[model samples]
Target: MTSAIRPPAAVLLPGTGSDEVFVRAVFGGPLAALGLPLTTPKPLPGAAVVDGFLAELDRLADQYGTLLVGGISFGAHLAAEWAVANPGRCAGLLAALPAWNGEPGPAPAALAATLTADLVAEKGVDAAIAQAEAGSPPWLAAELSRAWRGHGDGLAAGLRVAARRPAPELALLRGLDVPAGIGACTDDPIHPAAVARAWAGALPRGEYGETTLAAMGTDPESLGRATVLAYLRALTAEPVREGPLEGI
Candidate 1:
């Protein structure tokens, strides 16, 4: 009997200081339901650590013959960077809550990583959660607090790495012909709508949408599934003549 044909593989990169568990709960669950060949979500190795995360991606590309790259926040930024570097082998890019596409400032992830780690170390998870919840939607604060507790050390390390992460240059993403789907939020302080607009203005194929941490946690599976569907469709489909990033 012939084996069943699998769908193309997707590489998921989590936000800074995040691990597979949180990413899976928030992003992977939905993408997996689509029946795509999904690889395990992985953290991008820090420069200091020098783990061969990029090399693994290269291997996956060779083994699968094609790949779709998707990420959240810092993950999204990295995905864009990788897509720019490897346009031919990449199937597409799914960038969620992309931060600082071309802005000149510290990368949000670096700031978040350091601050989150500091909060965790000083106030403990419960206190940190409470503090964050003071301003953030309850659901997001809760989910992230849980993540903070579970991944404090890694978060600290990632913060250190992020603090040094340079702002992503436009040249890295400009003129790339590959299709891309970008998800943004209306209320996220870190993920400004203007940033999304800028990204839409630059990529060859870019679609913009909205999401929130509270909404995401309320129905992570549904949110992730919808996002993956949108991303996959964008990946296989042709670019729309007037997408968000058309003029750029």
Candidate 2:
């Protein structure tokens, strides 16, 4: 934790249909415990959601000399995308619940988001939220209820944006060349743990940990700790010999 290596702050993003409130609930205490400041950007409304989140990360990187960026699900994908594009600006990465590696295609989270978007367009936010809540975990249902309402008229557009956005490619991830810690909810059907594991395995210097949505519902910090601990592990792991990770 030398001053030279420690980042000034962590910029965390929330997932589709989620907001800064949830990000705070999950990462606030854990980041605070690390004596690290946390910035949870509010998701932008409408079709430009993905671009807007990436812009927010860019802004934070400019504000601080180096950034430790992270997010949940869709948010995690965006964070990694930015890291891949701006490896020099990234100090490290702390990603949780990555939904997919590249073009979303038929990924469960992407499909769910797209379906919810279409539902919102047809039935309105209230009805769409009700339908989405039907079979979801109570905590998840309650979260969508609150967050979807917060998005209001723009909810559908935002959902569509996330559903269609492409994540960083595996080649881009392999070239990111930054310490990364990935976390996953092993039981999360929408955001599979295997996705997180793949992301961790792709990076030249990365580590991963797992928790469950059930545990996350009871203790939001469970996800945060899993992510941050993995980050610490990646950070402290012996440095790999200097070279391009092109073929790693």
| Candidate 2 residue pairs that clash | none
After superposition, the stretches of candidate 2 with alpha carbons farther than 4 Å from their true spots are 1-6, 238-248
User: Best-fitting candidate, measured by lDDT?
Assistant: 2
As a whole number from 0 to 100, the lDDT of residue 30 in candidate 2 is 74
TM-score of each: 0.77, 0.92
What is the TM-score of candidate 1?
0.77
Residue-pair clashes per prediction, in order, are 3, 0
- Alpha carbon deviation, residue 183, candidate 2 (Å): 0.6
| lDDT by residue for model 2 (41-97), tens | 998888777878888888888889788898988888889988888888998898999
